[model samples]
Target: MTPYKSKKSFKTRLVIAISIVNLAVILAITYLTYRWNAQQLQEQTIAQTQQTIEQAGTNVSTYMDELYRLTLTPYYNDEVLSQLEYSPTNSRDKLNSKRVVEGFLSSVMTLPRSEILRVYIANDDSLYSYTRTPNDMPDLATYAESSWYNEAKETTKPLFIEPHMERVYGEKPTTVFSVVRQLRSKNDNSKTIGVVKVDADYSGISKICNKINLNAGGLLLIVNSQNQVLYRSAPIPSGLEDAMADGNKIGQSGTITLNGQKYLVNVLSLSNYSINIVALHSYRTLMAPLRSNLMKSIALAIFCIMLADIGFYIIIQKFTQQLFEIVALMHHVEDGDLTVKAHVTTNDEIGYLAESFNQMTEALQNVIDRNAQLAKEIYQAQYLAKEAQYNSLCSQIRPHFLYNTLNTISLLIKCEEYDTAIRAIESFSAFLGGVMNVSKDISLQKELDICQAYLKLVQLRYQDRLQYDISVSAELYSEQIPSLTIQPLIENAIKYACEQNRGQTVIHIVSCVSQDRYSIQVSDNGPGIKPETLESLQQRISTPSHDETEPAHVGNIGLVNIAKRLRLKYGNSASLDILSSDSGTTVSISLPFTKNEVTQ
Candidate 1:
């Protein structure tokens, strides 16, 4: 025998191999754990951001609503409404009316609110103003041409205007959003008197939004429906400005890349005010801690792997000689020489392992011999079981069709139509003969004939109430289809159309060929199946039957049975599809052209 030689000893190779495997396993676990934690943390952050935005939106809405109530203050004061209706021709009466309106507006502004900068009342004849800050008033002559005034006129409710720098306050250039409402005559409510305008600065809304904490470099924006930013904590990025136009583009909360950095965006809509509060959180900043921890974990794992390899090297050195003998025998077994055995010199763990190895090889040889004997039997059993299942599905269709045809004939006889009854009996006999050989497939031509016979029987029973048209090319008729395939579909259309509908029902049977598929469609002009029933039927046909021998007794048994037979014959290459609406339902069966011939 050649002397056994290895470039490296078993102890050194084992220590290296074990160290590499341990390192790989540790890295994979660390990576997966990091990923899971990252996903969970991101989701939590997004959820919290959404909640915060909603709360801030609520606060803003409450503040705006309170401000709106202030605009209605004129209606509460009879003196202000009376002064709004005054239009004096003389300068003395005009000055007195102006004093009354200004006094009322000043009292309204003095209600302990610092945000309300100006209040004004205007009409066709004159304008009055009260200012809490040093600001010039807008011209009453040009006020009606303003966009906010036009919008305010459209509704009786107070209108909240978008933020803009007040043109009248030219020196200070104060940005303000205003509430404008129409002042109507109290005695004649439909008669217009004047309008009240309340201009408030952004300090109130800013205070509400400032409560949100989005970490460093994050932003919170208050925007209108037109995507105009009313307030933002930071300057808008380049692409992010256009992205905010469609809420559907970036849903309520998700991640987006802006300025080469990722961010988490959350949105809350104030529909009543046409406002949205958007929060942006920095993705890099949020995950910085996680990345740092991952790096530390990897460093610790490397150190642990080195320590474990050192300990494993010392332990493996103690028993390598004994294991080497067993390993050599294992090499012989791997080379198909199972007769080789290891020499046992001790009753320790290694000795027991060697004995068990010999017993395992002996048992494996026995199992291989038994498996060869069982394979043939199992295959034959499966073949018989499949055949039985196919035959059983075929048998189920015959009795159901037979019972219905016999009932139709009985109904015809009771109607005193002796000649039609005899004709029906003859057609029923022909249809019965067709279904007699249920185990074999027939050509599409024969299947069409079978469907025609069934339709003829149904047409006789319902007389003029049923009309059907069958159109298929003669060249395509040679394609083979499973027995009882097309007949059941035609029967289903007739039953729901003629039996369920009182009016005349029309059905169309057509066939067409595409790329590599041949499809036959059956459609009707009767009321269609309900959505729930159609879904149940489609599900039953799509799902495979767990028990091959179980009969198709649920949800349109005829359809379920035909679909199953098609699947059994052609596998998934065959399909049954259903389309329906209030107008009608269409059922189509598409089969691969390559499978046009019977598989037997």
Candidate 2:
């Protein structure tokens, strides 16, 4: 028995065992060696790139610090501050103050190598200047609306404005970045006088960003606190730039991808902590060395594998034939061809294995067929439940409506309004028959006719109390609405309003179509609902349970039922909205619409 077992084991998996052992040793060592080298290379590259980014950040901080410092000089300029606060009593006084402020601005406007193109105050005081006449600037009214102007006005610190198209020197648009500082009162230094704005040199920022080193397809950006680009060295595709541009706070490094190419993004907050310096590197460039090494390893692996080959082609063929046939059968099963069967001609272990596999597949196919049948039954059950619900609601509607309506007709006839009673009966009969056509959608026109008939009865019931109006268009008459959709809303209004015995109830049904949306609003000025009840009603309608079985109270004016039916038909593109207040309640239904959607 032991010898037989050993022979069976040796015959069963011998070629597989040797193949696995040989391949595993070769692959395991190669992957480990490759992984260690790649990790080391990545760490080294990260360190180098981090250092480069730090250096760039340091240089940029120094430059921005100089700009921040330039703002400090104006705070101490008591001469400009005194003039900025001075209120001129006469034209002569205004002239004298203007000249003094002009002298301060002229020197600033003409500074050598200055990025400061225009230095001006955004104040309307007769003495302080608004601009120094390179002749075209934004309107003074617009300055009040500018976000940076508001930021500067509210803060004591210097603010950096992101680059934008502005008429700084003339009417021609140019890229302008600005520094804003709130000027102090000369007499009382604690009080702010006005905002002082100086446009920075765009060329200078371009010089700084251009000097940073990056491989082709790489990018660099200098951004303000808002992460709006104040300067960018290269244009990046939208897919990559959108997230980076929107990112206000991130740690040192992250990865982003664009158009199938990966990028490494490094962020550094400048020393001032408001401005950010960003460096983006092409990931391929960083991984080029690793890729080259992988190719050499692959070549070496081929050489070793060639030397290790013992040439077992014939033996492997016999061993693999059964496996290949099994694989082909699996592929057929995967493609949903379940009819194919394995032909097991031998009585050996391979034949037994094939037979077992075929039996398993047949059982699996049977299970799938049963599942498909169950799915169809469940779908049919759902539709049937909804149909029964619709019919059930319609059946419930008839007795409630006909009872009240017949009573109203009797009242009208006794009051000697014979003509009105006859017309009411005809309208009632027409509406009652239409309600039972529950299989198809009825027109809004038919719905309106039902509403008119119902309202007539309601008026007769409470002759001086109920007044109703319908503003639905004749053109909209052909648009399909659920059977009894409008009537339920009217019924709900009449039911609650009459029960409360409100002296007067005014109901208005209005509908309109705009763009691709259609809406119907049923508004009523009646005794409003209690807030808690209204809330409960809304919650119940919007959040339906999965249970489709009819509840005990599925009879009259089921707002949730109407909502469920709309949701079931339109699949979330439709809505039922109810707004109620002390004075009135308005229920609105919205659905996707087009003129052609209205069937004859």
Candidate 3:
């Protein structure tokens, strides 16, 4: 009897010891998994956030390039050059000059994005422009002594003048960018006939800077090469002036406290421009998402650990009837059989183990089921999101087509060409019908046709003001593109180039094969964008005045939207770039060259 009692006591003690050891192991595994998952989540979140910011920067740069190429360059070439070259000299010339200047002003005023306040022609001892009355002409002889006139004469190139307080327009302060071109007769290239001066208001620069939406509580500023503020969303403090002195490159990053709120300031230099852009985003905005994600992860980890503990306890108790049942249950759980339950009975050490086992199994099973449901929901949500995006893309086509068609109608009306109008209307209807019925992905040929149709409409609208030269390789016309991709860009080009200052807008649309990709380029010779405007554009910060309907400068929305769409469709495989100078601006896009059959 003594031996029997001793053996039973030993068995009970052994069971208790084994159960405690198993519980400790289970808890350790649960804690480790929680920590590992949390760490991974944190790292992933940080990586994604950084990627988003980087992509935003890339997008801004690309958009700015497009705006510069499509809008600014063409205006400078056609309108400004014509006005400069042909201004009249005699009484008859003076009469013609009045008509030409008035016509030019009318055209400039009609351009929605034109920042030019007025244009002036300086010839001999007379200065002619709509800005001055015949009786109130400013002293033309004294202008050569002024810095702007001297600079224009010195550079022999288009000059963007700095901002200054002016009393000419009113007591209200005004700034202007002046482009002066020496006009000589075609027969006499060496003799300077006259000077054509285009004056763009600084308010236009400010308007462009204001439209970029960087972030909440972030400010975007455009400063000239001289480190003088060309445009700012807000006033700069005197203390920061020394840091922003002429030719000084603002450091890439720094901490700045404004209005008691800390901001992370970043400055990016514009490519091929002498301007610098400064961006200031609140540090709190950057860290808020990270903190929220961390807190949620911690809460989830704690909940998971508590569940693991309860599951282990119940699982141990339920499987106590068999001495090794708890061990077998643990093995099954480890093998991912979260549903396995310990079925044990007895009121001794085994029973206590069984109760713990049941508790553990219950908790783990609940967690597994919840995770499975969550995964299913996430997958469904992703599918729905994709579907919504597709639908949104489909909807965008109609408005664009309608806009182009209406423009065509307007042009036909102006020309009073009834037959051509009818034909164009019919073509537009058929195009719309085909577009709506066709698959989302279309042949490159079809895309080109769409672009041609749109361009025809634009040409009709602008009449003789707009001219385009399209050169596409026959073999490359079958490559696929997202529907309406090139049209928006073209529209943006016409909006800025054709409409600005009655300037002759020349758009060169050319396509070629480069390496393994198909490249398309749109080049224009308009009034080149200000360096500060280009810099502000590259930063993508929405200025405060962007909500105004008629912006004084070109809007960045079309460029940004196109870039984002490209990224969504083609990931990192596609490319877009903009190069601008005083002479012209070029926007180029490249995409993978797939065979026509593959695109279909």
**Which candidate number has the best lDDT?**
1
lDDT of 1 by residue, 331-368 (tens): 88888776776767778998898888879878877787
The residue-by-residue lDDT of candidate 2 on 248-284, one tens digit each, is 3444677767788877777887745456777777777
In candidate 2, list every pair of residues with a backbone clash.
115-201
**Per-residue lDDT value at 282 in model 3:** 55
Task: Tell me which residue pairs clash in candidate 1.
Answer: none
Candidates' TM-scores? 0.42, 0.40, 0.37
Residue range with the least summed lDDT across 10 consecutive positions in model 1 = 1-10
The TM-score of candidate 3 is: 0.37
How accurate locally is residue 19 in candidate 1, as Cα lDDT from 0 to 100? 73
Worst 10 residues of 2 by lDDT: 126-135
> What does the lDDT read for residue 422 in candidate 3?
79
Off by over 4 Å in 1: 1-28, 88-90, 132-139, 144-155, 165-174, 215-217, 238-252, 296-600
Q: What is the C-alpha lDDT of each candidate?
A: 0.78, 0.69, 0.60
